[model samples]
Target: MATLLHIDSSVFPGETSSSRSVTDAFRKAWGEQHPEGRVIYRDLAADPVPHITATAHLAGLAPASERTPEQSAALAARVELIEELEQADAVLIGAPMYNYSIPSTLKTWLDNVILAGRTSGETPSAQGTPVVVVASRGGSYAPGTPREGFEFVQNYLEAVLKGSLGLEPEFIVPELTMAPRVPAMSELVPLYHASRERAFVEAATKAKDLAERLAV
Candidate 1:
C-alpha cells in the first residue's frame, strides 16, 4: 500500500489556518483516491521535533559503532525522521510564511532529516520523491510584486527539498491570506478568496493526479 508523510506546521488549528485548510483538502482527496493507503501525520505546532544539536550534527558524520552514548541517542532521533521520509511514497507540507520565512518548527524538522551522504548528497535516499508544499502567505510575493524579493518560504524550501534532497516539489500557494483579517487590506479580500478557491481546486486535482501516478 502507498504511504504519505504529511507534516503541518501552522500555529493555528483546523480551518482557522489557510495552509492547514488547503492541506486538509489535499489529504481528503488523496484518501478518496486510495482508501487503503497509509498516512503518517505530524502536527509540528502540537508536538515539535527537537532542534539539531552539536551532538546530533557530529553524530551524523561518525560511524554508528564510534558514536558516544549521548551522540547515539541524538542520532537515533534524527534517524527516525529520516527513515520516515525514505519510506514515504509522497510528502505533504503546510509551510505558511512566518516573518517572510518558514516556521522554526519546520526548519528544525528539515535540519534533523537532512544528513550529508544520506538524505542529501549525490544520491539522496529519498531522491525523486514527490513533495507537495502548501505555502500560504499574508501578502503577495509573486514575481513583479512589491515584496517579491522578501519571499523566502518557497525559495528556501526549493533549495533544501529539491536542490539538496532531489525531491520533486510542486507548490500550491494561497497568497494574501490576511486580507480578510487585516483592515487596511480589506480591498483585497476578493482576491484572497479567489486565491484560496484556486488553491483548494489545485490541491484536490494534484492529489488525484499523484494518486493515479503512484497507482500506475
Candidate 2:
C-alpha cells in the first residue's frame, strides 16, 4: 500500500481554517480509497519547525567526523525530515494564500525538508511523486478577474520541488472568493472570508478524487 504524507500548516483548526479543512477533505477521501495505506501526518502548527542557521546549513554537507557537535546534531534532525518526505508515496499540502502568497511556516518547512543531493542534486530530470497543493484565498484570483496577481508561491514552489527536491507538485489549486460568500458568514467581510474557505473544500474534493483514481 502507498504511504501518504499529510502536511498541515494552518494556524486555525476545524472549520475555522479554509486550507486545513480542504486538506482534511482530501485526506478523508484518500483514506476511503486506500483503507490500508499508511498516512503520516505532520502538523506544523502544534509542533513548530526548528529554524535553520548558518552553522547548521553548512554542517549538512560536511562529513560526520568533520562537523562540530552542535552542527551535527542539528543536521541530524533536518536530514531525518528529508528522509521522511522522500519515503512517502504521496503528499498532501494545506496552504492558505496570505497577501496573495503562501504561509511563512510552510515555507520554512519546505526550505528544510526539500534538500539537495539526496532529493535532487545529481538527478538529471525532475523526478519524484507529485504532491497536491490545496489553498484558500479571501480575494478572487481566478484567471480573468481583477486583483489576479500571480504570486511567486506557486511558481517558486513548483520550480524548487521539481528542480532541487525532485518532488513533482501535481497542482496549485486555490479555492478563491467571488460573488455571494457562504453560510454561517456573519458580516459581509466575514462572509467574504468564509466563501473563500468553502471554495477550498470544493477544490480539495476534486483534487482528492483525481488522486485516488490515479493511485488506484
Using lDDT as the measure, the top candidate is 1
TM-score of 1: 0.99
lDDT of each: 0.97, 0.70
TM-score of each candidate structure, all chains considered together: 0.99, 0.80
Alpha-carbon runs more than 4 Å astray in model 2: 124-126, 172-174, 177-216
- Estimate, for each residue in 148-194, the C-alpha lDDT of model 2 and write its tens digit: 66655667677877767777676545444322355432345655645
Candidate 1 lowest-lDDT run of ten: 31-40
User: Candidate 1: deviation at residue 155, Å?
Assistant: 0.7
Prediction 2 TM-score vs. true: 0.80
| lDDT at 46, model 1 | 97
Tell me the tens digit of each residue's lDDT in model 1 across 115-166.
9999999999999999999999999999999999999999999999999899
